[model samples]
Target: MSDVAEPAPSLARLGYSERWKALFAPMADDDFVPGRVMRIDRGIATVGTGAAVVAAEPAAHLVKTTGIGSRFAVGDWVALAMPETHERAIIEAILPRTSAFVRRQPGERETGQVVAANTDTIFIVQALAPRGPNLRRLERELVIAWDGGATPVVVLTKADLVSAADADAMREAVGAIAHGVDIQVVSGHTGQNISALRSYAEDDATIALFGASGVGKSTLVNRLVGADVQATREIRDSDGRGRHATVVREMIFLPDSGVIIDTPGMRALALWDADDGVSAAFPDIEEFAHACQFRDCTHTAEPGCAVLAAAETGELTDERLDSYQRLRKELEVSSARQNDKLRAEKKREDKIFSKAARRYWQSHPGQGGRD
Candidate 1:
């Protein structure tokens, strides 16, 4: 027999860090495979393992025990089991996530949706063409991104369409609202200032692009990837909305740097679990809150409330406080609704299990079954 060892390309190219290794050590053995989820279509996920990109279905036990609604999304790191029959690879288990981007769907029904998982940074893109800019929407996106535990970088696209002075003014206006976030103005057509945006993506990091429709998110993704990975379209003359160019969340690896996930443009980004993000995004208001006489000051009508005092002294804008209070109340209501839904779902599942047990006992007449 030849004395040569085959290269373990999969393990070698995984390039997991010490932190990731420790995170996975408790859940994975030495022989367990590691991969990053690149795309999720329907229920099947395409994972990038070092050996090759493989299509996989989550294990049946994982599917049954964990709600599919809350499990494995695009950009998740997962553990894989060797294929038994050389036909299908099984996603044995999902490694714990470092961060996830989640939002509540806009509708009568109360439901939370996970947009992406394990993202390191989020690029909040907004177009400066057609209309100047939607400051309110930009603020909302910032809050959601901050809450997701990722650094939010604002990308103001369509700079070539506007005059130089107009672009500077728009950037200044956005910078005022953005507070401490980094903002870049780039034109996909002219390739202006694209390098500033590229500097964020380094090795072993993942960045996600999020923006409203017609904001040139897909176009920017195409430019960054240096190829037509996503479809692009022009916005309507009447409104700033463009056609839904990207329908799914997919991850693409850069030539030299890390991965980027492009998502469908969101029209409504309702907040879900964003209390910390709200505080971080509105640091001015938070700083004022610390000076309040009472620790629990609502800042609405309380005397000695530093927030109201700031607004009166022109240190804080009334609009800013109003937006902050509105988002806080929305988060409160959404959290309560989510808890209620979870309780209701649990009760429903319990009832179904009880009924099934009764039916089984009736059929067998002497069988003892427990859930």
Candidate 2:
């Protein structure tokens, strides 16, 4: 059974535009049709090629390619082979993405996992339930969202569980760290402010909901689409934490509007290639650094560090500065690891080429290089 329960939407409805047309025009293969990847199940992907949604597998190039890490994510527009058998569609290529929400693959050193692709906006869904959303985790989510090149909106869910005053207080706390991001509080129980979320998806934009488990992202998806597209599980307290987690990253086509991508609740969103993300997430810190005497001041115990001065005077919270410093250090460590990996790869490649060259020269007598 296909995970895409709704009828396959047209390519335009799937957020195809002139950009897609330009990309598809150069493809010499006339048998290929553009399609948006709806979901990936097992080794097969459910792709919506305007005509219909069909299960397809990636062609050898997409699978064997070295650099393209986790090539397909929901919201990616791909070139699908038009074969005689409708079920035999092959994903020949993945079009360049406008933005991708990526994080370090869990337990992997430097590999990145794409959570969503070609996303326009990301809702950093945080729960305002019995225990308020983890402020630290919310900040980290915002960093990844901004790093992905999509607009981040801090969405506080489960507002019904809290008093109106408490909800407002949580929103303000989020606003303090979220900087330029917009914040919205929606309660599924009261059906309050749910309609407003739809506006973010207007103009054929693709919005993805991202947060930790039990944030009500599944329930929010069903509500925003005005249907039971995503099955919601009861909030389980078996482990002292309520969770209604989605199984996989799935795309939901909103009726007469845009697309909404609901992703599996992530337990840990590790940082991956997120230098600009930290800068974007901590704009207030960046602003303060401009007035520092030394350009490379670490903002810790530096005599002329404006950031430290702000914290001392309560212009900036000590916690906020600490978060910025920690993320910056984390990004630096990730960068060093990636550099080492790349250098090792280059060294291995050179060794292989040298062996190949030696064999070629030995076979060709005086020939030392390819002509």
Candidate 3:
């Protein structure tokens, strides 16, 4: 007789939806077990297998080959291998991710970093206190989120600190920038309009909160969990910047709904590879591009360029167009570098194969003797 083991409580509690079931179908025949990564630090990660959360390390082969890109993050769905010894768990593979939030790390290194994976929605939180709201920063965040394959929702926190009229005005201003995306005003201190935000927390869904420092992201997270899971800190009065409140990216599962991943607030948001997002965020510019005389109009000095014409006529702000162009140029440069690396790799592989073929011929001279 075969032994039937009890299913993990956490996976059962999360409920097996058709979508998740489909996602798991590919792994059912494999020897690995499925789990959701809850936290990651150094080179290790804690994954929840519905039964229990366990600390694990990526298989040595995977790590020695690809470095950190293939390693686990907070929200990745990974496959685990349990050895006879219970102490050391091995993450053999990662399930295909539906969505991932990636950004360029702000440093001298020129590499993109994956902030969170498999997020269904991203709450781009911004504060209405102290210096009011930063529309430019919000616009940049929206572009990145949209490019990351997640729906972006603008959350204006700290409603209690601002006057009702001021809050309404801020909402309107944000609405103008967001276009059709949803915007919610909530007070983390007073617990206002949190119910509206709860709808996105449906079963099997995952949401991530991202924004600048002192934006009340941690406070909002505490309200949602119904406990102070995250620490709250005040912004410095002089510079209007706050200390890093949430240091690590961690996933917290809601009681009846889904999970939320909270990460430390970011200071610099450099564009990575968000051309599609730029187009979607600035639809007006995209629309004008279609009317250009040449199909591939650079829109800089080309004749009959509708985009540049729109900027000259004040239909589109030059500053907005400039920002769009700057991002596009960055994407082009990054793509070129990536393509060059790929070509170089292909050339090296070809050379190695030719060398191997020559060596094989030399070893078996009787099979095909030289003239």
Candidate 4:
């Protein structure tokens, strides 16, 4: 590592702390500058330093890194190297993340994509307009949020379109799935609970807004920031479905409050290594799982299954128990797939190394025997 000083004061203004400073100390390089990634598009990233926001590009080494999780993501603190040949600074290294929101990469691959890094809270926004919030999706979102090492807070948006009674009912439904997490109800149109929502965006805290389109994530961000930083569009009147407004993931800093990372509406959020997250998200199921007859009981068809017994005796609802089993099975399958991928990768590497050794032996036949 090249010798460099601690992060500048400008970084402190953007949520830099002593923890990050200590992590950066060993990786510091004199030739590189430090900055936080605010936006990334088409292999280019917009990084915000205390002085100015600059566009940066990942270096060749960073590009060769395999999984999207290994690459630069919004909220990542990076070390930038200014090369004379290119106009954009090269992101040479990414600082260790305290927490990262990740989901399984789209398609058949077992890899994952890191959505955001170093996040303190994940605002799981769900609209309460056309229909009540999807508790199943909320449960899944909570799993990923907990898996990412960030606190999960459910935010029910579009309450203005629905009556207060309907909003309260929806909140109760969500509370069933949310467990101990805080649930906030807010309306961008009526400005209801906007102050309470703003309270989470305290100074130096990083919060990421995640939800489907038309969930009022952008509107909420605009309200909290006291400016229309993110563009908002009207949803389709017929279905109340919203268009993909925030197409990119971007970090917006609030002058008075903290920072907010806005992400586009996700079509799907598949699980990836969310075992602990599932247990944390479904504490009731985990609590019963401890009393299972067998340590590896599946709970579906097992003797002395406390989880199944709870469901049969009216202690737990069938829907909730089904959701728990479904998510648990998904996690098990994902773990198996990931293990297979790792073994395949190891075999490929061994084959490559073996071939290289054979070629070296042929080139230096006399010396190969001695060494």
Candidate 5:
């Protein structure tokens, strides 16, 4: 729901499966109509309700009770209420999300921003043209993807820009850090390896494409969906930076295949409650830490630190260790900030409740009022 608008298709066409059907069964006989959020723009959401896609206005009460993170997102299954007086349908409720790609909301707000929800696979797209792949960014991407409970596959796009030998070398370099994750090299221009990427889109599955701007994410989505469904713009030739061509997050259904959710290029992918993701992204480093002499080793200058020792003996790269430590510390700091924010909000709520209760008692003396 970050930006843009799109026409709705059916819920089944949007990759609604048995899992979603079962999850929605609880509200079967209710007046609510089930739909999947295809896109949301300017407080209005485009939802596909099994029968047809339509624009729906989110109910104010739904937004208030669920908070921001629980708000409607692309790929979310929602209950809709249609009124005769209104042109747009009303989003009454959002079903439980099986998975979500979330990040820390920017600028001093200690909260999570769910970019996309209910995704089964996340394509960590990194371009090979703009000075090859950024290993550090890839690590960050993997951490969030793992944290979001989605299987991540590294998609090395712009393969046409590099020679076959160079491509292989870059793949190996990326493989060193990616660990168990799959890596695929494809070119939107040449149409190479595009078919191989179809495996994730099979059987009503939902895939999310994530990367920085100008990484050919939109172009790749066009190829996957076999149409120019998303707009494409050229990256700046001088700096290799891409403009935000796809300014919004959207879900597009591929004919005879599964569905894909294309999101705007993320400029800042800060971690938000991604401890499990960090561990999953850097399993090797965690394994080494188990053998450290100190139980609370910071892995910086601690003596008998197995991680640092491994780095010294050339078993592990110092850069990779540093990335791990940096991300781990970031998570710790973010968690503390979030906890503080929650405490403050709770305190404010308690104060307001106490004030309201005192006023009620004062006004109703017959109801055992203390005043």
Candidate 6:
């Protein structure tokens, strides 16, 4: 294997097409250049301009950043201020994204972190562990991916560990829940179906990887890239859980075509603004709701509620309906909390403005006679 991976793709090949060209054309200020965010680490961003992937900091105004969720994501197209000297470039502006994979900040109400932006497709990588894929978790991931406006494909890794029959059984289970989506079972180590994963990103498309820790995202990334760009660890023998290997979300330019954003496994994936995603992911439930007696049926015990009827009659599995209800209820509670946060912020701002206004009027008592 080559110690060095292939060089990064050109800006155009990095999905910097005419749309980006038009967006950056307006801000054609001297010394300002277009760049894509490769990765962000410790207050510094690795931005890949056409020329080079340089260490960059956000323009002073954009700096008060916290984590990956607060600022530029892995796939953001940005405008950078590159000076003549050896100083790091400045990310002046983040161009509008075609799609954004946003999740609620874990343990925080009313805050969102965009996992990746402008991804044409998102590979929901779930390892086929000895216990099998977690159906409920897969459902939640589908909701977020559907809501993010990216084509979601389920890639089950570690096929070599399980028998063919077991892998087939697991794939069928996943297929049942992952309705209307492409599903692939592959061994990243053995290179089984790796080419199929590559086919999704043809013609300079961008793909984002999302999954929980110990799912072999890092191993798959290294295999897909055909280089040891990311680290890998073995799963625990006792509990069958793999250790976390990837730390920062990094973007790599594929030698074959397009770019891939490899992200660290998430411990928690709370929903942000995924109401539409819920409907999209659960089309069958939505279809049943449309035929219900009342428009706002919660699918619980509502009389003539088609969803409940379906669940009772074995048309829809009880477990699946429960998952759907849980997600809906979670979204409802999250939405309320987010609204409350927004209201409190507005009130605080208003109080501050009122105090400033009162002080100005008191200080300039005679000068306030505009009438």
- Candidate that would win on TM-score: 2
In model 6, what is the error at residue 15, expressed in angstroms?
Answer: 2.1
Give me the displacement of residue 221 in model 4, in angstroms.
0.9
lDDT of 1 by residue, 1-371 (tens): 11111332243233356766777676665466777777888887877767667777888888786442447889888887766564556788887777778787577447556788878889999988878778988888899888878889999999989999999999998987887999999998778998887888776578899988778888887788799878877545567654687888888766567678999889878887789889989999999999999999888889999999999998998888888999889998988987898899999999999999888887887556543
Residue lDDT tens for model 2, 1-371: 23244466888888889998899877736778898988877767788878788888888887887554438888888888866745468888888888999899899877888888999999999989868878989888989999989999988999988999999999998888999998999986567899888899888999999987777888888888777878776756744255445777788888778999988789878899988899899999999999999998988787898999999999999899989988888888988999999999999999999999888887898554654
lDDT of each: 0.80, 0.85, 0.79, 0.84, 0.86, 0.85
Clashing pairs in 3: 11-50
Candidate 3: stretches off by over 4 Å: 1-9, 12-16, 65-69, 108-110, 234-238, 339-371
Candidate 5 C-alpha lDDT tens digits along 1-371: 21124444656677777887888787777777888888878767888886666788888887676455458889889988877677888888889888888888776457788889988999999999869998889999999999989999999999998999999999999999998999999999888999988888888889999998888998998898788888988645657664688887888887787888998889898998899999899889889999999998889999999999999998999889889989999999998887898899899999999999998988888897674
Q: Every model's Cα RMSD, please?
A: 5.7, 3.2, 4.4, 4.4, 3.8, 3.9
Q: Which residue pairs clash within candidate 6?
A: none
Better candidate by TM-score, 3 or 4: 4
TM-score to true structure, per model: 0.85, 0.90, 0.85, 0.90, 0.89, 0.89
Q: Where is the poorest 10-residue window by lDDT in model 5?
A: 1-10
lDDT of 4: 0.84
Give per-residue CA lDDT, model 3, range 184-274, as digits (tens): 9998999999988888888657889999877888888889989988887764555656468778898876767788899989988877777
2 against 6, candidate with superior TM-score: 2
Better of 2 and 4 by lDDT: 2
Task: Show where candidate 2 strays beyond 4 Å.
Answer: 1-6, 68-70, 85-87, 238-244, 301-303, 353-371
